[model samples]
Target: MPTCPSPRAPNGSSSAQLPVREKELTRQYDLLASARRGLPMVRVDRDYIFEGPSGKYRLVDLFEDRLQLIVYHFMFDPAWEKGCPACTRYVDALRDLSMLTRRNTAFALISRAPFPKLETYQKERRWDRLWGSSFGSDFNYDFRAALDEKIPTVH
Candidate 1:
């Protein structure tokens, strides 16, 4: 979540600088320093293993001559072919991700669809990049991405 400042200021300067309190400034500075000292991570893993149509692979496999793996999950299940429209919407927006590749990081897309299904989708989208498919690998369930807390799903 983020703050939404009023479009117009009381004095109407046409723009307003976000106000940061002393405590907030201090906290932000500390966070910045910590980030400079070491990269921030949402979750770190060194020993995760997954399977796919090709074979078994480790988290490091996604690194591919790099040191970081940025992965996005796209829904591509054949059973749900013409897959979940909502998920498709998300995938459709991820067209250009070259900036992530400019650095020493590898970006991959993981999906439940088989290689063939993924190939078809990629062809339709005219996507040139390779996106990893982990169908039957159960990686989604293992990562808790396929589980629905609201309902008992086969995930």
Candidate 2:
């Protein structure tokens, strides 16, 4: 009977040779990270308003006194009754983000749908994450999240 070959590394070589390749990959990743950090930054000059569960809030308020803020552009057109299925799936896959708080970072989800609709959906999904509505505001368009001109205007 013929014996199967030993398990190989991702490059099809023997696993014993992975140490050198792993070090090279680690260096490449470190360099890529440094390049990303050196990229130019754009300053947000406009004071956009968003409606949340409590009330209207300014863009700066979303930071929650954190040093950094990460916004997830959720796709939920004003005319649609429900949010985009792909965006919903992405939200569903997210695990606990408490680590971001400990790191002095804040996260929020922004969508073009009305605040009422967002509130209903949030309740249905049982998501307690910070969510805000950019409805009737230019925040979505300015951020390039709502680029489609065919979307119906919210009245």
Write the residue-wise lDDT of candidate 2 on 24-119 in tens digits.
999999998898689799999999999999999999999999999999999899999899898899899998999999999999999999999999
Residues 86-117, candidate 1, lDDT per residue (tens digit)? 76677777767677778778877777776677
> Can you give the TM-score per candidate against the true fold?
0.55, 0.72
- Let me know the TM-score candidate 1 reaches against the reference structure: 0.55
Clashes of each: 0, 0
Clashing pairs in 1: none
Determine which window of 10 residues in candidate 2 has minimal summed lDDT: 146-155
Top candidate, metric lDDT: 2
The whole-model lDDT of each prediction reads 0.65, 0.89
lDDT at 65, model 2:
96
